[model samples]
Target chain A: MKLNDEEIALRAGELGPLRQWAIAHQIKVGDYLGARDFVAVGQAHIMADTESLGAAGVDWLERWAALPAEHRLVRIPTITDPRGTDFAHAAQLKQQPWMLDLERRAIAAFEALGVLMTDTCINYQTIMPPVRGEHMAYGDTGVVIYSNSVCGARSNFEGGPSALSAGLTGRTPRYGYHLDERRLATFLVELSWTPRELSDWGALGGVVGRLAGDYSQVPALLGLDRVPSADQLKHFGAALASFGSVALFHMVGVTPEAMRLEDVVPAGTSLKTHDVGEVDIRALQARYAKDVDAVDVVVFSAPQLSLVEIRTLAAMLDGRRATIPLFAVTSPQVKPDCDRMGLTARIEAAGGTVLSGMCFYQSYAREIAEANGWSRLATNSAKLTNILGGYGYRPVLLPMEQCVAAACAGGKLT
Target chain B: MSGEIYYAAAGMGRKVRAKALVASDGFSARYDLDRIRGVFSRPEHKLAGESYQGRVLVLDAAKGGVATAWMLHEMASRGVMPAALVLNRANPIMVQGAALADFTMISGFDVDITHAIPNGAEVEIDPTAQRPFIRVI
Candidate 1:
């Protein structure tokens, strides 16, 4: 398939590793976009729903209508991809009243298609992304980052598109990142501080993401001595996607695609560079400050809580209770283990609830929160902070330790 | 734990802490109400949800952290100590939603509490009033 001008331009912005991989793979170029200069590689969820223009989008819809009618739409909910928990697992809903609603939404979507329904949020590691240098639609910033930087696949920071447009027509807009040459580094982010903590590194991603633009050339991050842990990397990619319109970044030696600072963008060649410090992170959760209040529950999962997070919370709240309640959300993968170890019982005795699979951010609509008079929510994800306010609920953004501590106190961690 | 530290009429320094304090929940005078309220008061003398079922005390974490703690001292004057602890995170309206599911058992309910931690900081309710007040130092 012949790629469009926009697709060509986006591919041009890819980093060297991805760029080279695309060129060597001889992938067909998908055409039909408007942008002529730069196309940032983007991903698709179902791989066929996105369209280059509304016209194409409409045309594809018409064609889908004209089909023989043998095709079926698949729905994947609860878990974006299937890494944990089958698509039909009702145990989550049985255990948590909230899971009932979640399973309903996903089950309706996958009424027939039978989506993999992997529960893990990290699709790149848990599920396979489009082959190296292949263009695909995907959600989750970290997955997008991994696709563009590590797998040589290209995608955008898709929230709705990555999830919805995946099965519309089995075709993308035919623009941005679908071609070679659009993946080169355009902007340079020189990091002058050492990121000691995962949050700090995540902050760096946020700062850079905000600075980066639609046609962002791969960013060459400098000034850090240590590599972030996988979990920390997840935070970094997530934070970057939340603040900036970025899909990926290049941390010189840190990135799988980037090897050196010079490899990002040619020196002094109409390329622009921005510098950031630790301040960007402080501003991320400006809404939820230390102004402590009566915190009843501390939620640990949004994009699926991790085992480390679960263990840490269990330990911190090993023995504590406030005049409030404590709640923790973890993936089902670790739930049975937590139960077997009596972590669940210990926490329950101390007054805390551990939920698996379902999350409050999306699963708990107004009805549920209003039903229980839970007008307030506490969390650390900036995306949740942005969305919770729109739902007529109060969300408390705090650090993990403080969140659990607040829960242990059965009150706010002020 | 929910209750009132009932002070004797026209009395000073004399407090009788009830095991359960029942009141409407919209008390956000302080940004961090839990610690402010929890640090000083014991769990038994906290707040109760939906007509007290046991000898539970009700303490609002919203009132002045220190003021309420000191004021609760008068609760002892009422001879209502040795109470069970019931901490409900819900506003006054959600007796069932914010019930002490972590500690107390409901008659026919097994509620799973889901914690939504946004970037680690407690995602506060009504952040519009906060106006960039969080600090790192």
Candidate 2:
């Protein structure tokens, strides 16, 4: 592949660590991207969300030199009340310095273009639907679904370049996923159980991610509900993205990109099909939960907390005191609103902690993990489950309401 | 269909009449608008749970369902068909960061109940290329 000056720019940059990271990660901007087919780039950011591990923060400038100069930038949104940490997930703030750097980088990138720097991977909620067939690049694991099914947008599971490639050349290298042929299914997922919980879908995501990654291929899931939740879609989307090289998948009744089932499965393709059952969901859940002693502390808001969630926390608290320490992290924008409404005070009064600009998993890794030894984390985010589970932490999956009750009563959702 | 109820509420401190049920999990909505019709028919109702109109009910399908549910109960305490839905991140109710709970809620049960945040088609674009891959399983 001929190297363009812009593409080779990173090889000649000043970011020593980033340069090393690029090489270690085997990243090539132009090799997989084109100059005229793409638009923006969504990357990671710092707001002390769960993905960052809430240490301090990082700046994108750290790797700006290593990334293609023309790449656009957008800040990743904060994930709140995340599920659990999987192998890929380090303790909270595991990538704090890196996150802070990413945030700064996004601000600078936004200066050059309309970089939509949101904190939540759930950017699809805002009508910024990614269209199918359009090349997209993003870093958030769970958010990948929003770009695939809901918005019918397309993109490979982008890693390093996700921060700035969109602005570097206004397009991505037409590589791996740029073509329809690559989008065909290599792995098949058969549904035997209709998932009713986010965690259930998320666990399935983990199974599929692990199973499909056998040959660095993608899976086309059949029989999932035609109308699934945005969160569920993103949850499994992110789970699969982080689980392996899987950048895209197909779902029935949803994902306009896969209008005809053949668009996803295709004909004459090598298919490895696996039938999933309720037993699989239970097994995943059981595997996720090693052994929870008792709920002494409930930490939600691995991602940034939304106002509606804050309101829910307030109502759940209802001037009551939790038996243990309960924490919920909200975005900087909604912090004051929570404070003004006394929701913060209510959560605090309930013996629970509500903090702004920081997520629990990211911020309390060492302290919580160490203090609460064997840290039986509870969450619904599939990405989190993979990260933490990989790290040997068993998470108890629960519904949002049950998590709140546990926080209030200082007990287990189970 | 046992007919699950979908509820959305802002702060339980507020109330909505119950003429119908709000099924969409639009987190942007502050309260279910269809439940408002119950306000006139059943002045005694507060959260839309006790008595049922020939047409409606209430359910909390939004984030912080606890609070939204509380509000549903407090506002339509006398109504029928009020329940709390427990969805996880995979199936989270769609409510953007800055979107106000009160803004997205509509009184009419006619809103499209499609979840726009989970699929590739729902992501926003600003002069940038769409993400080419999503690990959907």
Candidate 3:
């Protein structure tokens, strides 16, 4: 990797140990990934939820946070992904005191490093949306896929550590999705059906993602009768990233880069095309719902709800009182607006909890499930379904309306 | 099989020898592991119910979320982690986590490392070699 003078100085320790460590870490990752040089990124989003970070990671961050502010502060705009727990609802969620203490410490550590606690996976909708052709270091898989595929920005799956390194240096190793050659579609998918509900869209994403198989392969969709709304694409992209570890995808005639099939696919390229239909989407959902007639809880999260999604959920829950616990998780940015618009009250009136600044899976999911005796879970998010299995939850994938009905009808699947 | 060796395209951390736990399944710390139990917890995973502690995990590809980047380091800090990770392909999260944890990892072999390595076989991994490799010892 070629280093500019500033990079050299940082490595040489003239820029203090924090940046020195950060640049060295970047260079190590860059050389391994075959990055020739660093690319200046416009922003960095870090996913440092306490669940992922653990005690060691938080201690590591605090070590840096104790350093001089000049040495530790980020060089560019750096934001956070969802935290481990929303403090206001921690007790209700049955989160232990230790978990809350860890979250507090992690938040303080991030704040000390001059990181903004955006606490959102829907930053593309709630915070600054990246423009086409822009470069960024985004941590959350949902954020990266939405920004890269929907917004036409460039990024790889920058995890928490790499994203923080980019934040410190204002640059990232130029490789993977940052290169134009890597942006071209590797596989093609012909959609025989267009989805309406967010869950179906997410189910479609899961199907396509399984076909894509890995981070390096990009899947371009061919038949979308209509352009998907931002919220629709949000669920699709989140599930795709979660299920496949895929970074970017293209939807022909819809997404910015793939305005046409030829735009994303190189000429004369005979791609292996897979046809996905309504049957495939239904199969994916059925696989999750198999043998689960009832659920202990219903959740709406993973990408974290946009204000539009919240409004839609609120409307669905009107005059409906939930017998089972239902959660509507949204970003902090949208929560205040949700409150002011009475959406929060409306959802709460229906016996659903409105959680902000935290996502379900990221918030020590296993412990919370054990604490609350929540074994079977129902959610509209495919991303959440894909994740909760290992955490000991039998997650049922359903549309939002059905999820609401289940919540109101004592967790019965009907 | 006593002295067979497989070269990798990329590697990091130091060399170590351990028993191989091989599977042709994708890996994700957050999705497939129970860190508290030191075993593969996800029922669908190929290595489900197997103890991964201190064993070299030979797997197909990296999968799922970016939490593995931090989970790797956290796992190492707890003294419960794989001896090394040998994969056919690696996503950025694995590389980033290995870098942060200073854990042994080597990926990108000409052949599928998972198939080349036999389960529970004694093996040696050298990530610092001119061409990093894992050998059946």
Taking chain B only, the TM-score of every model is 0.23, 0.23, 0.98
Off by over 4 Å in 1: A1-32, A35-70, A73-111, A128-134, A150-152, A157-174, A213-218, A283-287, A290-296, A322-325, A332-349, B1-137
Off by over 4 Å in 2: A2-117, A160-162, A302-320, A330-349, A354-359, A371-374, A389-393, B1-137
lDDT score, candidate 3? 0.94
- Number of the top DockQ candidate: 3
User: Residue by residue across A247-300, what tens digits does model 2's lDDT show?
Assistant: 567775566756666777657666778998889777866765556645544655
Q: Candidate 1 residues B39-114, lDDT tens each? A: 2221112231223322332222221101111112222223222222222221111111111111211110011111
True contacts kept of each: 0.00, 0.00, 0.74
Best by TM-score: 3
Compose the digit string of candidate 3's lDDT tens values, residues A165-248.
999999999999999999999999998899999999999989988887789999999888998999999999999998898999
lDDT of 1: 0.42
Error in Å for residue A381 of model 1? 2.7
lDDT of each: 0.42, 0.44, 0.94
Task: Flag the better candidate by DockQ, 1 or 3.
Answer: 3
The lowest-lDDT stretch of 10 consecutive residues in candidate 1 chain B is B100-109
Worst 10 residues of 1 chain A by lDDT: A46-55
Ranking by lDDT: 3, 2, 1
Using lDDT as the yardstick, the better of models 1 and 2 is 2
